[model samples]
Target: MLVAYAWLTLVGFVVQLVPNAGPGALPRTLAWTVLGLGLVQCLLCTGVLHRAIDSYLGTRTVTDARLALPAVLMASMTALTVVLVAIRAVEVGLEVGLGLHGALAPFAVTFGVAVPRRTAALALSGYLAATTAALAAAGLPGADLLAALVVVGLGGLLSVFTGRSSAWYIAVIRELEEARGVQARLAVAEERLRFSRDLHDVMGRNLSAIALKSELAAQLVRRGSETEASVGQMTEVQRIAREAQSEVRAVVRGYRDVDLPTELAGARGILRAAGVDCRTDNGGSQLPAPVQAALGWVVREGATNVLRHADATWCTVWVGTDPAGRSALLVMENDGTRGQAPGGSAGSGLAGLRERLDGVGGTLRVARDGESGTFRLTAEVPLAAGNDATADEAVTDPAGTAGTHGSGTDGKDSAE
Candidate 1:
């Protein structure tokens, strides 16, 4: 509203500068006074009309009084300004001619730059153009016709600019919506993978045990000494069922633990299944429970990245205990040919891996070898001798013995 008043004041100042108004104190005073009053009324009408329009648009119910009040006020204000300007133009002793360009300027500010609707806004422009043509044909000389032509040309330019701005707005909105959609799909995919992992963990062990017990029961039944044996097998089956149910609940609650060796084995299977040769080295025995757990998460994230991002043909995984003190290193390297990364997004997966390891007083590193096109992920975790008892047990067991041994292998692992 204040802006509208400012514009009105500027318009009045311009009108007073028009040539050939006969020198008279009374006429000059009347013209200035009427112009000031018109400006003030224009501001008041603008405020009232603006509030009334907002109310009408904001509500579902509309009353006749709401519509009529603003209409009457705006009409009266516009009429007063027009009458005063017309009288002043006549008083200047020049034929009173309304220039279309000047008359349409306010509407252009509103309908073109402010509201910016296409069909309706352009319709308003057309009305302004037609009215200007009519007024240009009245009273004054060639100047009015020229002014009318200029107004129409400017209106066309305004429509183009406004329409272009609208198009750009729509393009930006569409891009945002697409990004939201992609995020939603990714969320759903993650949930599905979580559910599948849970289901596998819950059912795999128990189902295998159940099958073995049933086979033993069948053998006893065939031998006809089945009474006690069958009972024991049935008891074992029930026990396995209960264990499976407990595991299901635990997995649903996100409490399943991953042993480092188990995760390493899983990574081997996944890489091999993807037609990638899997080479693994763990310098003798299991890692400390805490270090192993952290490394397990690293292996998990690494395998996921390999499957989703790296199109690998050969992969190597290495895990080792720190000799000087308490720390373990886990490394997974894949010979994946990288033409280009999708979306050109630097690895956010690796960033998350780093953050996770950092929480456990560990660190992760991801590097790509350009020549070989191999991507390597490494995780370093702290551990203590007492914490690595499971690894010690695995080393004592001949069946569990695999990979190279000790600090000497650490140098080889580093080369990975």
Candidate 2:
């Protein structure tokens, strides 16, 4: 919308470049100057408008210094536009009457869209009053003054309406984001409580059995009746300990095997909650369980990196078969990779992902495009039967631990 208005303003200036006969050098020069200034004003105003909207949404805090320069430029351009149109109106005598009134519309609209209600309204009122007085001083008739006031008044109202509506829309989005955060925290707390209860259930029976057996063994030893009964009781205690250990391992494995589909949905939800647009495409859904688990970890880590390391506004996660159909590929890409090194040391999360992918006969790649300010993470694992067999063998090997291989660009390869 802002760009559209700017283009319209530019067109208005371009129209002014043509004269009655050949070309009026002064009018053409003024038109070019106004056009250049308007373009600069638009560029600066983009940042100011973004900051203003974010500030209103409670998502950012901007200093006055950031906004001051754009505000001044906007005011200067508006005054110049009005002056130019007023001079043309005096020269052309009522033929350029609409130009005089419409000169302030762009600035008024920008003010309404980017500034707070009271400030925009106050500034617009003052601007209208000044422009009106200037037109009168330039010998505009009383009827022309009334007509200009009506047009300027309507433009100001439109600006105010646009600004207020944008504020309301941003407020609603912020509220939804806050609600999502609360929901996520609640889910974490609930999961913690559930895990604690499971732990207690798993341990309570074994601990009770151990205590009873030890008491019986102590009694037998004190009475000196027999060592066999005491030995048997000790064996039962060791059995209970082993059972408890197995249960704990199962619980941990359950926690670690986060499903790929679930993680993808969660990543989308979480990124959207943080005001980042997230899109995911699952090219196919026939992947093995181990393969799904590995890609799920990639999605989780990529989302975390986007939130913690980048200032991205959009992220895309894609899972598809490689061009050769010999491997499955997972790619996560996001803009705003500021402060991140494209070919620097790998972070712990990426290092761990490398190890996991390697254990499953896969590769991990990370790249940052400095020109576009984007970060991309790519994971590829062969989809052949032998690849699954190799992964299974790797998991079963008692002494074969996952090891990392360097990928040259800020990521590690997880191939054995």
- How many backbone clashes does every candidate have? 1, 2
lDDT by residue (199-232, candidate 1, tens digit) is 8977987899999998898888888995897989
Clashing pairs in 2: 358-414, 358-415
Model 1 residue-pair collision total: 1
Alpha carbon RMSD to native, model 2? 9.0
lDDT of 1: 0.56
Best by lDDT: 2
Most TM-score-accurate candidate: 2
Model 1 CA deviation exceeding 4 Å by range: 1-122, 152-182, 197-359, 362-416
Native-vs-model 2 lDDT?
0.68
Q: Write the per-residue lDDT of candidate 2 for residues 1-416, one digit (tens) a residue.
A: 64455446445633453342124566566655655665676676565666666776667766767656655665565455455555552244232333433344445555565556788778877877876777677666777667766765675576557656766786886688678678869999999998889889888998999899999999999999899999999878776765665566556567668688999999999899788999999874787677788889999998987776779999999998888888889999999576666665668999999998897789999888977888889999777643565575476332333212121112321111
lDDT of each: 0.56, 0.68
Cα error, candidate 2, residue 346 (Å): 4.8
